[model samples]
Target: MSSQAAEVTEVLVVGAGQAGIAMSEHLTARGIPHIVLERHKIAERWRNERWDSLVANGPAWHDRFPSLEFADVEPDAFATKDQVVEYFEQYAQLIGAPVREGVEVTSVRKRDGGAGYIAETSAGTIEARYVVAATGAFQLPAIPPIVPADAGLFQLHSSAYKNPDQLPQGGVLVVGAGSSGVQIAAELRKAGREVFLAVGPHDRPPQRYRGRSFVWWLGVLGMWEASAPPQGAEHVTIAVSGADGGHTVDFRDLAASGIRLVGRASGYADGKLTFDGDLADNIRLGDENYLSMLDAADEFIERNGLDLPEEPEARDLGPLPADALEPIREVDLAASGITSIVWATGFRSDYGWLQVDAFDELGRPKQQRGVSVEPGVYFLGLPWQSRRGSTFIWGIWHDAKFLADQIGIQRGYLEYDGNGAPSNFVPRERPAVAAS
Candidate 1:
């Protein structure tokens, strides 16, 4: 390896996704010298990994960075993958974000004697006083290891799946009935293909309730603020779709849309895909949770004495009928003429390059919000980093700005109060508060 001069910056932010870009904007606003390093182009994940037809899970009105809402676009409409990519690109330019694309950070290590940290990247070494691991949570695709290698069927992870045309002319089995699986199954069915969806544990909220978006109700009930998982608890995967119209893609909806629903894919056996015999139970659990959320929202409205219209009782939210609750224990791919298996199992976090002890047993960073254990180290774009909205496109900016303020105070670029806190530390007001 050839030795090169190490470029130094006040802050080095890894990953140029929404989180990183947002952080860079804050740093720029504070006149902090920082550089954002990305392995690919800005919003590379949305640009390259997501399906072509993918849209923002949230509405355009809510999917935005601070001070930069979607313009000339329908606020209630969902932005597609391409539009999202373009939005991030425009945001980076608009904020004058100092980003260095195509620079992949290979390793990050704390410098000797508490000086700072050194980041090894393809473009050479970067020494920074502060290192913000703004890499989004989804670092690696998580396909179950138990998938049969000799199944002799084409396989694609949700991150790699583009469209139904990419699959062979046969039935498709989609494992994991989360957002990705349900959406892909819906697309496959729309393309006139046989789709089998393996149901899993997920939250099934109606896309719209009482003539308003379900997200609006969630905001009304403070779900986003209160939905943070207990510390060390696994985050719940909410099953919702970003497709046109922002429909809810629950197990019931998939089953009712001519897609066969099965239980959780357990493993392969007897030359077939084995599933648990709890399909009905899983569906019931989702329905119960959904109803509970609605009840909570109703209670919140009543308690606040809000002048919202009364929602009708006994409304049909489109769940699976009792007769469609038959459990599917196994599926023989060959017998069913299934040619492809789409694994929407979800993503795993990878911080192997970060040589720091700030990680927990599960390899997740240990932090009280975005500030890591080590001084001058921070994290961004983590799910539930501070609240339920921390990982979303519209929500990460709050964490980013908070981190920027902290970094500014640490670097003496900003002032701190007598209480040893950043003077600029102030909670951002929720936009939905007035509207609700």
Candidate 2:
């Protein structure tokens, strides 16, 4: 290769979110020569887009980066979005990972050599031996098409929502029963707003079990050990399948939490909204199923003579009021005085920028562990990329180690120079940053 050709990095990480940051930590630790390309600034989306009341759904213990742990000064529960950003900032400084912010990647194409790629960005072009797409699923927000037109209601996706204070001083209608929707609805209600949550089926497990955080119990039960079985192994199963398909927040608990529960966001017609008739029944059955599973788990723990803590008897959180259902059928846009609607439906992973044939029938990039269908291309931060919890914060470490090992093994197979850099990449001052 000619020296006039663009400077090549060993690895180019795209999207500087949690996963990107985590990968950077590993790369810096191994003295890998890499650059992280961020479309916006570090932790930009988390800092700018998320709602003010938003805290991580996962507990604080499980949310830190791979090589770092949250200090005891913070609560064990959940960190607010602001705190999360602060942690990532410190992590960036700690690793001295070279991150070029505001450099949007326009295209990623296979280079002629078949062992590298050329990433065209807004700032410039980067030639690298490997590309890691750490852009998470949350980037694409899903919004329904049936939203009432001419209803004069302010609708905002959860990504754009900051707080309820931005909404008009009236009854608020929150759409979706996902974690964000339920939590935001609860926050609004706690603030004395007449808040109604459009309920759908959600998987709700107890945040704490046996008087300890659920994650701690996971560690106690060998759930974190490599020898531990798959998510099917009782304790890890629920957390594993919860996000992709099986996860749901308890609507009965939502009702008990003082948030009004309504049917699914159906359609707006004749100045009123219609909903799925089975929504109420769905919430009831979902909660029953979750609670029953918890009870079954407890029975299994006792039968196996596992060292388990005493569990509180579970109880049913009764259904929503029959009268609340009537008003929700068609909330008067002006009379009900609800100002904002937050769509927390879900996300879509669009890798349209990567012009490559690595995708499967489902359009997801095909890879064995983190290695791609195309050579020299690697992936990280995918849900269940290796195991059930592969994409979660705590689960990312295993994938990182696996990817690092794969890179090392492939380097050995090709006889590439593997031993090259100083042990440390930590910076002595604030890391260089740019805002998108």
Candidate 3:
């Protein structure tokens, strides 16, 4: 830390991933003076943390910012991990975003006897009238400690997982049936390794349906506008893949392809692992959600009187694979020959440096849309922050725009009426937007 006086700015944006870049873009458009502080290189998680075989779940068109996109890749194709990172790098350069990389913010708090906030960082302290926490979603990977530490099985989180060869030579057990787990299981099975997938509550939507991508259908069906999850459907994840030109996610398909299907990993004791007994019901629910999505799409097409081809295979998912119906309740690790476990159980917020009283007990920010209870402090890039789409690339762009708009209101650069309509809005492009 520098012993000099604190550096001051009009706004300070944290984290230089998609959300931060998006926020920077909007601030630049509005000619607002701001500085973006990054803990590492831009798009660091996508560049280093993700698995080697990782690909965007959404298609390229849906996963890019409005101004820039990936070249040479098909619009319908999902971006590879490298491609996604490269895209962001190019986008940041093109937008001329003020991203000061390698500067990590350790603590952010209200300034004493001042009208704004102060961010303590590795470089020095930064004072700003407003701060946008765009640290992104994958803050910390959540790995449950269900199995004992001395269980003697090699285990790692999905964030640390790369290719199939990184694991031990024996079989692998992938817990959590979300996008990460299923993709890893599929990749391992492709590598001739016996894989056991622990199924959890997931909505297995296909990569495409009726001559359209699943995300396209969601956009058309107005499903992405949902600000909150329906009752009992909070933890459910859509398990579709965009690797190898995209495909549907089917546990039965995985089972038929030599990968074993099991229930959620519940406990392990007496040298035997136990799974939940509701495997059948879980599979049944996934099938229902799958068909219902297609049904809803079909109805939307019919209601709108659109000429589109129907996919017969999507309409009928067929019976549950016989193996999926049988729950693998308990299996001794030695007996099953399972040598490794991959916990792709998703992530949780890791905002210890954020010292504002705007978070829930679970460390989740308490906010409506991107605006927090704390004035001049905002959040971005959270799923369903404003809508379900807010988590996706373009959605993050829109969310960032909304946050920038709010900041614009605060900066007196714009104004909004009570109904949330902009009363006097002007976003000019002026050089040197950020002040000392």
User: Which candidate achieves the best lDDT against the true structure?
Assistant: 3
Per-residue lDDT tens digits of candidate 1, residues 204-253? 78777656677787777777786467454364567888786787655655
What is the C-alpha local distance difference test score of each model? 0.82, 0.68, 0.87
Off by over 4 Å in 2: 1-5, 148-150, 217-250, 256-258, 300-309, 316-335, 416-436
* Alpha-carbon deviation at 117 in model 2, angstroms: 0.7
User: lDDT tens string, model 2, 18-71?
Assistant: 778778877776767789999888888779988876677566767676567665
Model 1: CA > 4 A from native? 230-233, 304-314, 317-324, 413-436
Task: Write the candidate numbers in order of decreasing lDDT.
Answer: 3, 1, 2
* Colliding residue pairs in candidate 3: 33-433, 33-434
**Per-model TM against the reference:** 0.90, 0.81, 0.93
Question: Which runs in model 3 stand beyond 4 Å of their true positions?
Answer: 413-436
Error of 1 at 159 (Å): 0.2
Backbone steric clashes in candidate 1, count? 0
CA shift at 143, candidate 1, in angstroms?
Answer: 0.7
Candidate 1, residue 401: Cα displacement in angstroms equals 1.3
Per-residue lDDT over 71-141 for candidate 3, one digit per residue giving the tens place of the 0 to 100 score: 85788888899999999889999989999999999999998897789999999999998989998666998
